[model samples]
Target: MKKIALLSFLMVFLFSCGQQAKKSETKSEDTPKEVVVMSVDQVLEQASDLAEKEIAVKGTVMHVCQQGGQRCFLMGSNEDITIRVEAGEKIGAFSQEQMGSELEITGVLKEVLTDADAHNPGAEHGEAEHEEDAETQDAHKVLAENQAAAERVFFIEGVTVKEL
Candidate 1:
């Protein structure tokens, strides 16, 4: 009888241990993972794959849109790259004072498709219209100059922003 009682207690202890382990597993699964913080250049380089993903990034505020104070531009530490970040409703508008200040921003990275015509309007028509008119030519020139601009353009939908 004593042996049977000991065995039953051990079984209960084992079962409770298993239950606790399962609970811990579920708790860990429910918790959100930490976001990796990156610089503007790193985010830009990985923009295609990182699009629509939430991430944390640090950069110096280069410019803030004055109209309604809704958006601001951030530049990498080396000043090699810049990215746009729109302020979230929770955080409200970004003040002009934030410009030139290093900021740590947590947000969702987004990619906006550039206008197809802006990239190559003539190509869609074919080689027959090789000689684009002055206006068209001017537009093409502007587009060519800003070719990298579109590819590098990424907006961070700001979740939080703080000076660092």
Candidate 2:
């Protein structure tokens, strides 16, 4: 029967066309690309959840603290996530002045989750441990005071310096 043959051919062609359409739809879904801009808390959570995992974060400079004589951003906004900038070794060469201005820093997010050897586990105690909390507290107070004293409103360096 000619009608039967024609109907079979039409059905086969329609089914094949449907499959091709389905394949194209599936291909788009298969590739997953996701980028998220996380707040400090979210960034900290992600850093803790997946240590050494590469991530991107953006925030303004809240405070800059000097630990081990190198400048580090004591970064915060409404929340506090004591994230540090990568050391000079990691960032090549940079200075505290660079941090004085608003910045969009991109680096590995690291957190010291514990300091079991000392009190208040996870408190970053720099290169040496303190004998007691008071002594450590005083030392930090003094160190902070010293840094505060030396703190300048602005720093001029490199080509920015003038011959006045």
Candidate 3:
């Protein structure tokens, strides 16, 4: 009788442990997925369709354009679509210091229609804010809001930055 009781208790303990492990595995699989990762060419191909669309892409950081203490642009190889980052946003996860490094950027891909969007002739990146208007400032906010609506771009908020 004593041997039977011991065996039953052991079986129950083992069964509970197995159930707990299965539950933990299910929880891990439930983690949120990331935005569709695209290559530079694929991103450009879908750029028109993705206007105002939040995108995440990995590419080599051809250059880093900095301005206004903390503002910076993480340019991909094509130089067509650069990811704009703000002062508080510059934890060095992506910036000029990261030039020549490969990186993954997640932001709202926008069209550079105006001259202001064009590169300046004579200014090192990280010098000064070109346009301090409410419009430009709001642009950053819009990007942030847009990102929030869909998905978290970088899993680490800012640390997920990849230098391609």
Candidate 4:
């Protein structure tokens, strides 16, 4: 009887240890992945898939926001593709001289709708909507122009930038 009890205890302990290891495995899965560095073209190609994920992208600083330096546009190596990088809490702003410089930026990818009401198909485009006043008509025209621009824009919320 004593031997049987010892064997049963060992079996229970072993089973519980196995379950504990499985729990640890699940915890690891819930953890975030390590950051990976990518180029502008690679990021743009997989933009949708990489949304909300932290990544590092290397590009040339094409344009930095002159108003507040809060945002900068990064161009690909070939100069055809561009990705916008926005200053995050850690990154206060980008300097003007950063333009024309190659940089490796680490940040989370973000996407924003340029115009939330982009081409509202359900809304009627009748003259009644724009006939309120001349100002209203001008506003409508501006809104139309804005809508015709990029419907959605993808950018990176920059965290760190390293000139290379």
Candidate 5:
């Protein structure tokens, strides 16, 4: 009957369409993974969590180091929020021409103790030290606390730069 013919035709059409869909979709290991790019504000907000990790940030170039183009600062929507980007071995230097230009920079986040924190290694943190006999870690505990307390500068060591 026509009903049986119609059902068979419908099943055949559905199977053919499914085969085409499978052929159209493909996954290759050689394909590069997509990187999650953060804004300047996000980078500053998540500085501690993102430290030592490679990150991509988009912002407007606020200023560039003039001496030898070693570094540059990126400004977020909030003028107070700015992240420093330093030239890595790959980047020779940030040019003055980048000033006011919007850019997406990829780099590894790094933090260093400030001069004030460096002056006093073991300032006041006493309880953080766990080892009783091995007492040399007092400075390490205090320095870790100081670094956690925002007494350090967070900068990104630039790996690549793209102007957008």
Candidate 6:
């Protein structure tokens, strides 16, 4: 009789433990994920790791590509860092008026590889080897300046935008 009672108690305790573990697992699954907000510079610095990941960023719109209205450049509060934000299919064009306005944008980070790099992967070395004339040198200097403006250039495929 004592053995039967102990066995029964052990079975009930084991079953309750299993039930608690299942409940905790369910609770974990139901927990909401924390959202991370980043500045334009942080995103630029982490672009290589964050590429293809969705993130929220805040910045001031510095320029919008007026011709297509599909893309805009955003500058952080520091002014030294800039990132490109591209309108998602559903969001449509970004207006010129949006420039100078502070905005919170949520999107996926994407790398934009230039045509030359995309087509001929080895072309970068060839371009670096070419001798530059005075005019070509000036152009190369401008390109280098642009490249130095940010650690890494990335385009955000905007999922949502709100002016702040």
* lDDT of every model, 2 decimals: 0.86, 0.49, 0.57, 0.85, 0.84, 0.82
Give the per-residue lDDT of model 4 (tens digit) for 10-125.
99999999999999999999997777789899999999799888899998898999998999999886766899899978989999999999899999898876553454423757
Compared with the true structure, what per-residue lDDT tens digits does model 6 show for residues 31-123? Answer: 966569898988887889999999999999999998978988899767667888889686788999999999888989998765322444235
Per-residue CA lDDT of model 3 for 71-95, tens digit only, reads 4444555677555543245344334
TM-score of each: 0.69, 0.38, 0.42, 0.58, 0.63, 0.58
CA RMSD per model (angstroms)? 6.1, 13.1, 13.5, 5.8, 7.1, 7.1
What count of clashes does model 3 give? 8
Candidate 2 segments whose C-alpha is farther than 4 A from its true place: 1-37, 65-69, 79-81, 113-164
Top candidate (TM-score) = 1
The CA lDDT at 17 in model 2 is: 100
Best by lDDT: 1
Candidate 4 displacement at residue 51 in angstroms: 1.0
Worst 10 residues of 1 by lDDT: 113-122
Query: Where does model 6 exceed 4 Å of error?
Result: 1-32, 115-152
lDDT, model 6, position 71: 88
Tens digits of per-residue lDDT, candidate 5, 1-164, equal: 99999999999999999988776664444565677999988988888899999999999998999999899999999778899999878988989999999999998998876754565444544446544444546656665676667555699999999999
Number of backbone clashes in candidate 1: 0
Rank list by lDDT: 1, 4, 5, 6, 3, 2
Q: Please give the RMSD of candidate 6 to the true structure.
A: 7.1
Per-residue CA lDDT of candidate 1, range 34-91, in tens?
8889989899889889999999999999899989779998998665678989897976
State how far residue 149 of model 2 sits from its true place (Å): 36
Query: What does the lDDT read for residue 83 in candidate 4?
Result: 92
Q: lDDT tens digits, residues 1-164, model 2? A: 99999999999999999999999999999975443544455565555464554454555545544545244443446534545554445444344565544444444444443222123322564557556678767766666665545522211111111111
